[model samples]
Target chain A: MRMSKIVRFSADVLFGAILIFGFYIILHGHLTPGGGFQGGAVVATGAALVIVAYSYEEVLHMIKKAGLMLQESAGLVMFAGVALIALGLGTTFFFNYLANSGLLFGMSVPFGPNPGELNTGGVLPLMNIAVGIEVWGGLAIVILYMLSGISKAEEA
Target chain B: MIETIIHVLVIAGLVVSAILVFHFRDLLAAALASALFSFLISLEFYILQAPDVAISQAAIGAGLTTAIFILAIRSTKRYEEDIP
Candidate 1:
């Protein structure tokens, strides 16, 4: 069932904020406490809020299952692709080849206890983002699928 | 002193919420109690300086799980029936 108008409005407002914050956590994983899984869970929670606030049909219109599945598969492929690239570079899989190599996200860290640089951590940020995307898609899809199942059962 | 007091209070609240979850016959109220327990646990994690874990717990456990449970309740019975 659909919620009250006020609840829907609040959910939309909160969803925007949570989405931004979750991305911030993912992007800053190398410098912060939160990484891919945590940030992805946060984003999925925001999506869940929107899902819960709206009816099943409304939610399906807002978020397509096919799109979410594509995102999840793409994220997994991207994560593995990064690891494979390391092997192509003649290093071990999941190697941090870009660090201090003057490439994207390649800045080296200082000795100790200093403020973190956003550009550091080699392929760590990339991996974080990939995992974040995967998790967000997977979790939101779980909730969405469950709702769909419930609706189907109701119709029968 | 205050930190210790806060810790004690949080722990007490956790116990109360956990018990309330088991005590409630209304599944919805029990779900809310469980959510409260998750929230308190997340708060404890934050106090322990594990913000990442806290955020995940708060979002997934307290927020998402509660929403899912509520949805399930909507599709089924809101109150538990006696087995016997």
Candidate 2:
């Protein structure tokens, strides 16, 4: 049976809030304690809440596995691409070539243990976003796929 | 003194919930107890100054795992079968 209206409404509200918070954690990884994996899992948890609130068929209509898989693949490719770019730049793998370049997300971190600047962390922030995307798609898909498999097994 | 008290209380709660998870005969109740255990552990992580671990635990351990377990339980029996 579908969840009650109150539960569904609360889930809907939480859904948006969780997505925003998760992205915030990812973007602020350099400045905060949370990073890609944690943020992505948090986002997937919100997706799981909405999925559990509705019937499998309804959830299937709302979220597509193909799209999630594509997102995951794209994230992996982008992460690798960024790493590879460092190599092409005559630097070592995963090198922070953009740091202190005064470019986007390339500002040098302040010396010592003071509060960090948002635009710092060079390749770290980019990698964090990429991993966040990958984990978000991968974990959500895992839950959806498991639920679908269980339901299908029950029907047999 | 207050910090110690809170730490003790959280640890006690963790122990209780973990025991309850195994003590319950109803599968659903056991799943909920496990969720409680997960939440308490996440709290412990937070108290230890690991917000990142706390967030992931709260999300994956307490949230996703509980939902998946509930869904799995819903597809089958709610009570444990006695071997005797």
Which model scores highest in TM-score?
A: 1
True contacts kept of each: 0.77, 0.77
TM-score of each: 0.95, 0.94
Using lDDT, give the best candidate's number: 1
Provide the DockQ value for model 2. Answer: 0.79
Q: Encode model 1's per-residue lDDT on B1-84: one tens digit a residue.
A: 999999999999999999999999999999999999999999999999999889889989998899899789878899899989
Model 1 C-alpha RMSD vs. true structure (Å) is 1.4
CAPRI quality band, candidate 1: high
Candidate 2 has an interface RMSD (Å) of 1.1
lDDT of 1 by residue, A1-156 (tens): 777999899999999999999999999998988999899989999999999889899998899999999999998999999999999999999898888987999888889799788999999999999999999999999999999988887788
